[model samples]
Target: MMEQNQSGRSLLKQMTLREKIGQMLLCGFHGTEASGDIERLLTEVPIGGVIYFARNVESPEQVERLSKGLQHIARGRGNLPLWISIDQEGGMVARITEGISLMPGQMAIAAAGSLEDAYEAARISGLELKSMGINMNFAPVLDINNNPANPVIGVRSFGEEPEAVAEFGVHTIRGLQDACLAATAKHFPGHGDTDIDSHLDLPVIAHGRERVERVELVPFRAAIAAGVDAMMSAHIYFPALEPQRLPVTLSPAVLSGLLRKELGYEGLIVTDCMEMDAIAVHYGTVEAAVMAVEAGADLVLISHTAKLQRESFGALVQAVESGRISEKRIDESVLRLLTYKAKRGLLRMDADEPAAVAGREKDNAMSLAAAAPEQAERVERGDRSHLDVARRISENSITLVRDEEGMLPLKLERTLVITVATEVTTIADEQLVQAPTLGSALADCGLEVVDLTVSPEDVASDSARLLQAAEAEGVKQIVVGTYNAVNPSGDPQRRLIGRLNRLGKPVAVVALRSPYDLLAIPDASVYVAAYESRPLAMQSIARALTGQIPFAGKLPVSLK
Candidate 1:
């Protein structure tokens, strides 16, 4: 191990200026395959890494092929092994959806209230990602979702409590690292209290250092203590941390001073995509990439636009040549990059070692087949074991907020199920699996069901029609699923529930997204919080409603 580490440092000393600059960049590109611009970047510019989005993924086989092809290209050019990364944070933020374990979101895991579950979910996710040749996962969001009004980090967060978030986040980090995949605890100093999405515009946290320390920085401290491999910077501004109101990604005070010196984190510091509006709209993409590196980010990520990627590479090269940014600073980052790669056993296969590269690929395939044969088989068949784990967690996470009128265990033979169509609440959420209608699950429980799906905008106009349909059918029980109904636009859903109450039928409301929906509709006689609108969650909700499974989940966040 000592010799390997020394060799990595020795290799860094032999690198050219452009090669050292490339080590600081992690770029993204279009298409499912690595060709054209992506191939050119690998051969000429020789970027350090690549991040996968929904656009770059199709299936496990395709992803494996793409990852292997990219690594081959980099190796062919006598460059270091590429860091193939992805945002497989589970739930709505997942990139590789098909043929993998789709674990419950962070909030759902918290609601389940088991640290073991959190660890297992991440371990499973890490193993599968490793099988596909993805070395790093930008995951285990350390943000505590303290603000009910937060648009981006709601379900992605573990919970509102600092300690609970810390415990779960650390366990997730351990799980991923134990599986030999790097886990990134993200969005520091915190993104949990903002209503605005950084993908759209800059958000600010104006709290003093004391308050920020108490809430926002708790999970991050715990993550650092756990030896997390990477930390992704947030685009949100922290007034207390940086007086200039710059995003944390570009603020030296926040990234270098606070995170590095104060917190004592020695891991790789990666910036969130430079193309995000919070950075790009305010500062040019090429400029922000340079600023992020200057701010102490070891890796500057540009997730879209190949033109900007090339420009940013050239700009960084020029920055070093012109003495705007010292070559020594570039070498510092490259050294860190090489060290991390060496630690991960990524530096063993040099360009001359084709047999070693082929052996590594064979090892990955054999490990997948031997260790997780069931998982591999499930990829070809249906109903993966990981889904069973996901379903079990979902079942445990179904919180019975209230059942005032004793409406649970649906006594009626026939029921009416009303569901609101789901929308992508934030740019982070891909909404891969449609939340299956509750009617089918309920029907499987022996209740005759009538299903109705309504758009959020048309709910008010269609309320009367729904009521008439319910009355004409003589339905005595109604179950409605609400998705993020705490927002101002959810007034129609609130009013629709009010109208349904007057019909004299037992109305049970299930919050399919945010658990805070009951806070907006306090008059609801029977309310439940499913925490998410995914298929497993919906099925779990259906089971809980019929008493097939008990509501074991406790509220991770306060309803008040």
Candidate 2:
């Protein structure tokens, strides 16, 4: 340990301001394999890490070659091995594919009712990541989906409660570490309650310290207790913490005072992408980086811009010399960082690879998801899945919550239904669509469906009038299926279903998106969940509704 200490100091003394700055910015290298501009950037920019996006991948065999190439780039920066990282959260957010076993989203893993499942997935993910020459993964979203209307989180969160997320998040972290890739628990201080998308605009979590400590902070706290190597800050703002309305990424009160002083999280603290609108709209790139660092961010992520990295680095260097940012503080971060690198066993690896293989993705995701319980449940439930319950509370769950007496199933086969919603643009829309699309399927089933549409500005009036018209036509079943509205329309949808029920017609509610929407329109006599808003999912729901297929879907997540 004494000799190790000496070597650490020597290395730190030799690093230039550019080298230190390079260690902070995590650049993204596009291409199947690292080469050309990637090499130049590694040598000149001397970045500390590289984040892989879908554009950088092909097959898993190619991924190993890509990783080896990045190791080559790191040689120019004093032989410091670059942290090769990917967003491999599985289920929608995966980068490395082939050979590695893939699991469904966190909810599926949590639903598996076993921590071992989470560990196994993370272990295999880490093992594959390591084999491909990558060293880190941005995974295991720890945010509790306390709010079902949250579009960005959905299946990404382990579950709707804090305890479940904490249990699964810890297991996942252990698994990744077991595989040798440093696991990251992300969007620190929580991104669960916001109804605005940080990618498009700034969202504020108005809860004070008490609320944050009780719920949103649980998973992160558990992660810290487990000694996770790092945590990623969110781009969303928490007004209770800062009066300036600064995002957690730029809030010293959060990173320094709370996370460090209260939680004792001594590991690395990384900021989410600085290129995102949450930070960009508020501050220039330079100011953003400076603020992030001053606010206690150990690694400021320059996920997109090479130029912005330069500006941020220049600003930090200036701050150091001018006494605005102390070198001692910088040194503390650098030391912790160096320790992280050492812990990864980088000093032992040669960082050269012409023989690495990467068939992990193909083997992992497709095969594993196909064999998983979620697939089995999907097969069982057919189209009527995701009831926010453990079992098929099925026909019983289609409650007439507000109806004085049950309305009769409509008598007319010539039912007119028009769809008016589109894909969700952001993840924070309060209302989530639970039923699958019933348009073409409705037509194919020989129902004379009359479709209606509503604009964002005129949706309320439009939906109201459309229901009235359906009532006027003596329509049998007015299917209210909207899979694209990602806002909190729980009250409105319930109220609408109530009106349609009063018309004394059978109302079949289909959710093409999240099953959580079913909770809003409890009065619908028959409810079908397609489990997704994809066109295929929509088609599947219609088939299931008409009894073409028995609804075999089991609840993968609990909505309550």
* Local distance difference test values of all predictions, in order: 0.83, 0.64
Error of 1 at 540 (Å): 1.0
Model 2 residue-pair collision total: 44
Poorly placed runs, candidate 2 (over 4 Å):
1-7, 76-79, 96-100, 349-513, 519-560
Q: Estimate each model's TM-score.
A: 0.93, 0.71
Alpha-carbon deviation at 331 in model 1, angstroms: 1.2
Q: In candidate 1, what are the lDDT values of residues 404-482, reduced to their tens digit?
A: 9988888856789999877777778763667678777787777889888887788988998888867855687999988
Model 2 lDDT-worst window of ten: 364-373
Candidate 1 to native Cα RMSD, angstroms: 4.5
Q: Which runs in model 1 stand beyond 4 Å of their true positions?
A: 1-5, 349-385
Return the clash pairs for model 1, or none: none
